[model samples]
Target chain A: MGRVVSAASAIRLDDVTLGYDRHPAVHHLTGEIAPGALLAVVGPNGAGKSTLLKGLVGTLKPLGGRIDRGALKVREIAYLPQAAALDRSFPIDVFDLVSTGLWRRRGLFGGLSKGDRATVAEAIASVGLSGFERRQIGTLSGGQLQRALFARLALQDAAVILLDEPFAAIDAKTVSDLLELVARWRAETRTVVAVLHDLETVRRAFPETLLLARRQVAWGPTSEALRPERLLEARGMQEAFDDHAPVCAVDHAA
Target chain B: MTPYDALVAPFVEFDFMRRALVGSLALSVGSAPIGVFLMLRRMSLAGDAMAHAILPGAAVGFLVAGLSLPAMTIGGLAAGVAVAVLAGLLTRTSVLKEDAALAAFYLLSLALGVTLVSLKGSNVDLLNVLFGSVLALDDDALFLLAGVSSLTLLTLAALYRSLVLECVDPGFLASVSRSGGPTHFVFLGLVVLNLVAGFQALGTLLSVGIMMLPAASAAFWSARLSGMFVAAIAVGALASLFGLLGSYHTGVPSGPAIVLAAGALYLVSIAFGASAGLVWRLLPARRHRAA
Candidate 1:
């Protein structure tokens, strides 16, 4: 674990292959992310962008090789999965949900101090949910719910922030406002890894990119990583990878 | 006689009625909050599963000790926890879902309890185990109720925050703290303990009613968890009182009477509760027209 990462590097995946039940979603990926560097994991769908993010966040263990979290301890990294993974019907209010970001410091069963409460309110205001402080989370629209989740991430203040498709299928205004938060996080020198598919947005907002199609295609400046030919090759590679047939006697999944 | 006389006179006259009221009240205070969490977490049926699971343990106690309170209680707690843990394990280790696994285990327990009771006991004794003898609660049963109630309240107060976070977003809680897994198990343990507490007052079949119906009804009224907790306790206490009174007056079985009273509250709440009730949902449009 020690040799796999360093304090200078925020993350190092030494030929890591992430999978479920031994079938690789992300296979044989080697990369070292420097501290304070923002990397956009650009990929086609099913190209293991989320699987890679989950591996980085320590939710999924690497199937082969290793992923050293560098200077980030498990708690120092904040990962937000897709909204569908969250239980929206949960009977919690906006204020309390945002306040849970302070969990790393306060732990479970600890109450918020007066200053901490003010910070939570400020974070809520930052996310444009001021009047919704008391609203039950179940009642919020998808975009508003994302804003509330982003408010929680703001309070987390982790050294490493990982977001899985935070801007997918939402209003443009929400995407822009949340993109601003991402930019602010980068300015603060936090290592931010975002799984992004919108090519134009990725090209405009992200400086560094790692384009993955089950394995590393190209990783460097966004200008080189998202070149048209590389994207076409990624598409071809994924399609060809899917074309191979492994026949089974029954549909076990069904 | 005035309405107050009709309500108050029975308790004033009968010492057994007074004792029954006290026992049910204690059951309400301890178990209602647990019910609220179970409802919010969508583990309401899990509480019922645990309630049924305690039957075999209590039946075994009855078989061995022949109507001793402590023996039955110890047996009930053991059976309840065993079912909870086994169901959890089955869900984890097998393809069976949590609900399916729990249903399988509880049904097995119920069948076992019934068989055990019938083998060595009379029909009257079997009836007592299935529907409790709340009117006949002795000093030992009263002491057990008080003890369980105290333990439930103290444990809940300590675990409330962990339990709430676990309910809302277990994955987030896991990312943040190491307490998530332990909190979940401790909560299940509390569920078993609370079920065992309520079982003596309302038998295995009826005990889960007091826990779930009040909480489900409260969900229609309060959007906030804290508010729902308070609402559930109030609803439970009212159900207990009214059920006890209904039992005394109409000659209905006490345990089922209490459960039916809670069920009645649930139906009323579904129609008239403030938050998501049927009538409540209809009121806004009517008010707008009037305005």
Candidate 2:
């Protein structure tokens, strides 16, 4: 029901080191996400999965390296952070929240035409939330809220979509429904990078996988990257870093 | 005096009371929605800070022009916007949190205001600056208030969608449109302009109460943001009406009387208003959890 975005855009990271306060969160990572690839970013807690997404979205610049956003404008990226990051108590209805996706084409004060309203309604139905259009977002349960967010993303209709732990604390039915939407995006050749914990779902749905633990541990087909030994090694590497480490005096990366 | 004499006679008999009513009504029309946005943005205290921040600028205007309306209004507008802008900048660049930066700037502004007013005038003049002269609003003050109200309503209507998007999902808005920055500054400008207008009627210290309290009270009755906006303006107007009567009958200070009336309304709404009122909590099914 949403507009089709152009395919054939790749994202490349050249030795990117992302961090806060000069203390590296994701260090010395180099990789390329091929055009239209559905990649799952799998890592343990503190493995910098979210940090890498932040880098790709241009929210946080690499402390050392370059990210070449090939063929895709920075505005053509749709990022869905963890549901917890959103303020649920905010007084917004589902329809208005979804319509925010039109801000690019319509602009700040742009009036919504009847056609725009129809498009928003179609996006809401695509996410299985048609009846909840006027419902306040705060009243929704966790699954419903995730559905609303997906509706917003559908309205966004961007080329590159990044989802950070979108399935956390959600029910199985909602997970499957959202997975179907992701599959649809893949069929349309839109690049989808999701930070996921459920390895089984990653193996079943994602074609490519990127394992990160303060660095690139592995990047390949899901089968190759999701091996038990590789997963264990990534977890160990993430946990080994001291949580209380002070800021480094000098950045060793040139 | 009977009830009619107490309530209706003051407004009907005296031109001053009528002028004060017009002044506060204009203030309510503009400032209430600004207050609603502030609460939505979690900037209520920052709104207070900006309110006090206007004082030094208005005092500068007062000193230069001897209680002229336009000078003080312009001065207050500049000061309020400067503080909002500076606080935003400091929060983005430095380690200072937004709340901390706002507190620091407002305290400095308050100190500057006190110093500026004391430099030229006696305590009587100081009283007017701090407490305002609602009953004595001359033609210029009335004109300023009405003009600001018109400007504020027009600006808000233009920026409505963007402003709401900015509050709910700023990250999404930033990704989709470049309008976020200009929308934000415009909203802030309106806030400052409204504060400058409000200072003429309610004074710096008590003016923010008129802006915030009714909006906060409105939240108890309305479920939607738009509903809350209308309810807040209505509540602000109602408070102004009765507050003037209270001042006329009881001889309490006018500005504080208005604020205290709003506060009382807030309390009543918290306990008995429709949306999240305390009466719902006392219902049997809900009372089981409390028990």
Candidate 3:
């Protein structure tokens, strides 16, 4: 049990390879993420973006890699899986759903303290769902449900947060509000990593990016890594668009 | 006859009938909450498997300890837990699915229990064990039913929040665990313990039906967990009382009678429950059109 020093790099994955069964999804990848930075992992469908996020949170163990952290145990990582994976018919109120994040602190056989309740309230407020605590989760719209999930993660009070496709299928206003909240999270100096599909949003909102297509194609600032030629190369369409100059430089810093 | 004479006569005349009614009511109340969780987790069939698995243990206890209720119940509980743990471990470690493992173990236990009873030359008592004879329940059996049901209810109340969380969202629990293994095992153990205790009143053949049908029917009427739990208990208690009366007058088996009552309630729920049931939805449309 190592204590995470304040303001240290949150995650480090070295030569990681992961897949379902024997079919490889992410082949030999290496990356390092710093604290207080929002990194967008962008790729097309079936590009192993979700797999990478799972690997980070220790849900899907990598077949081969040395994944280390700077004194921050993986339990300090909060994850918001895609909303579709949730059972919508579960009979729980919004507050109870958010309160699940406090499960660890309650320990075995311990009840929720006043401090725990306060944190839950703060988490709900942070997600702009203060007065909706008693509402059933089933009745919430897609965006409100997502916010409730985000509130749960906030209650976790983790140093790192990983989200998989948090913006998919959500309305435009919800996308903006969620992005605004992510920016606030960065301002609070927590590490935020999201798997985003909208390239334009990624370019505008995320400062750093990791572009993937079964392998690490580019890693750098979002604007530099998301060049049209690099995107083409990552998609394995280099032969089809060979005439265009490779506009982005691949950084070997990772 | 007056209503008071009819209601009070059943209790004053027969001690065995009084004991049977009281014992079944206690068992039904405790089993309802356990049943609700089992149905929610989609492990309704596991309850069936556990109920049947208790027979061999009960038979072995009877042979060794001379038909002592406590010895038999302890043996049955141990066997039920063993089979549940084995099935769970097999599913995790091997390629077998949980349902397949449960089915395999269920059949094995049933066959072994029958053989064991035959070896002891207690085939008559085997029928008693298979379909409980409420008339044969003694003071000791009644005490055991009351004791076990009370203990199970207390344990369930203590661990209510964690158990419900585990059923509804296991991912949240996993996110907190380093390996996410032991917490899951504890929940599964609780489920096995619940079914084992419930097996005393509801026999192997119909215990699962008693445990699941009430809860499943309750789901049609309520969208909240607390509401479903209350409704399930009400349904279970009513079924137990009605089944006891039916068994007394009609000479039907108590276990099957209770199950039939529960099944009837389930049908009514499907027709008239508030949420998605046929009558609840359809009648409203008709009334609106008429208006």
Candidate 4:
């Protein structure tokens, strides 16, 4: 078994192609994300943004190539999937739900210690949901549920964190608050990659950007990646791509 | 009649009544919480499907051993698990979704079971296998019921967190740990085991009724998983007790009596339960001062 690495580790994508059943959703992507890097993945709808996040987190294995997490074990990477994938109607309160973040550390059978309880409470408080600790997750508003999810991420204490559309459809106030939490992760020297939609927010807060549209359009500083022509090219590529295209010849040979 | 004469005297007077009560209460202890999870996972009908899926296996065992306990138990368990695994595989490998695949297989299994049971046995034997004879529980049947109940409780405790995580956010659980798939199968195994336990008392047809009705009623009373577990078990126990008494007094079959008792509670909970009963929904909302 690999020793769990809590310290930050660089994730290297080596000509990675990820897709479903030989149809490439995101392909031929090569990039190295540095430890402590705050990277935003910006792409249009159906541009495989969420797929990229899945690939990074090891949930979706690559169809070709490999994602090399230098020293990070599986548990050392915390992933927050889209809220749509979550079952909000489940009978769980915010505090218990957030405590699930301690899973990697405490594991299946371990009881939560007093300090762990304090940490859970603190995580909830940090998310501005202190008063709603006992509220059932089903009762929470979308923004509040996002906050609770962010709180769970805080408790994960992983070397790397991945968020899929953490702010989509969320209110402005909650977005800023969660962005602050992201900044805190960066300050703590953890790798943070978020799938983002708002170009303005990405340029403002994200130091690095990977602009993708079924393929890498730009991978560099946010300013360079978000350039107008590159953005237009990404949009065009997405619209023009054929879903029924045969397996990639390049991926086949490699 | 006095409450004691009506409720307490049946168990005190008849050995069969006591045995039936003990058998069913034990079955409920194991099965009701499993039903709660099945309900939470929105696989309530899947439980019914699995109950039917076990029938052909039990029928085969009956054919080979003439209603022997171990043979039928093992056969039913094997059949239930096979169906669950096959349905899961079909969902992954084919276009059909999980529920549709399950329904398809269970219907086939049900038809096969009835045909097989009718091959050698009379209609009485067939009805016995279908509706169960709770009042005629032998020592072996009682022991099986207790054993399955104890195992279910222990397994539920051991796997509670993992099972909860699997139910609520399977993707997240998969991302975080490797226990998701195994946990799911274990849960399905427990479901089958409980259904088999239930088969002895409520039989294949009404076994799911004991599991689902209490769980559905519990949903009305509790908003937390732990609370629902308690409520479900309580309802299950009460239904078994009342159903047995009702059977004793009314001459109805004990199996249907137990299930009907659970169904009655479910209906009552729908109207008056604390969580989201119809009365609460219909009542005018209280005006709240601005916080």
Best candidate (score: DockQ): 4
TM-score of 4: 0.95
Q: How many residue pairs in model 3 have overlapping backbones?
A: 0
Q: Give stretches of model 4 more than 4 Å off.
A: A1-7, A240-254, B92-94
Candidate 2 residue runs with Cα over 4 Å from true position: A2-4, A238-254, B1-3, B285-291
**How do the residues A1-254 of candidate 2 rate in per-residue lDDT, one tens digit apiece?**
43355675689988888988677898878889987889999998989999999999999988987999977788889999876466667899999888887777787667999999999998889889989999998999999989989988877778899999999998889999999999988887788999999988999999899999888899999999988899888978745556687654334434
Per-candidate interface DockQ score:
0.56, 0.60, 0.44, 0.70
lDDT of 3: 0.76
Best by lDDT: 4
Per residue, candidate 1 scores C-alpha lDDT tens digits across B85-110 of 88888876799998999999999998
Query: Whole-model lDDT for model 1 versus the true structure?
Result: 0.85
Q: What share of the true interface contacts does each candidate keep?
A: 0.61, 0.61, 0.45, 0.73
Candidate 3 CAPRI level: acceptable
User: Which candidate do you rate higher for lDDT, 2 or 4?
Assistant: 4
Clashes of each: 0, 0, 0, 0
lDDT of 2 at B215: 89
When sorted by lDDT, best at the front, the candidate numbers are 4, 2, 1, 3
Q: Can you rank all candidates by TM-score, best first? A: 4, 2, 1, 3
Q: What lDDT does each candidate get? A: 0.85, 0.86, 0.76, 0.90
Q: Give the top-scoring candidate (TM-score).
A: 4
Per-residue C-alpha lDDT of model 3 across residues A1-254, encoded as one tens digit per residue:
12232674657778887777644576678878887779999877777888898888887888777677778777888888876466666788988889888766774467778887887888888778889898888889988999888878766767888999999888888788778878767777888999998998998899999998877888889999899999988777222222353422322333
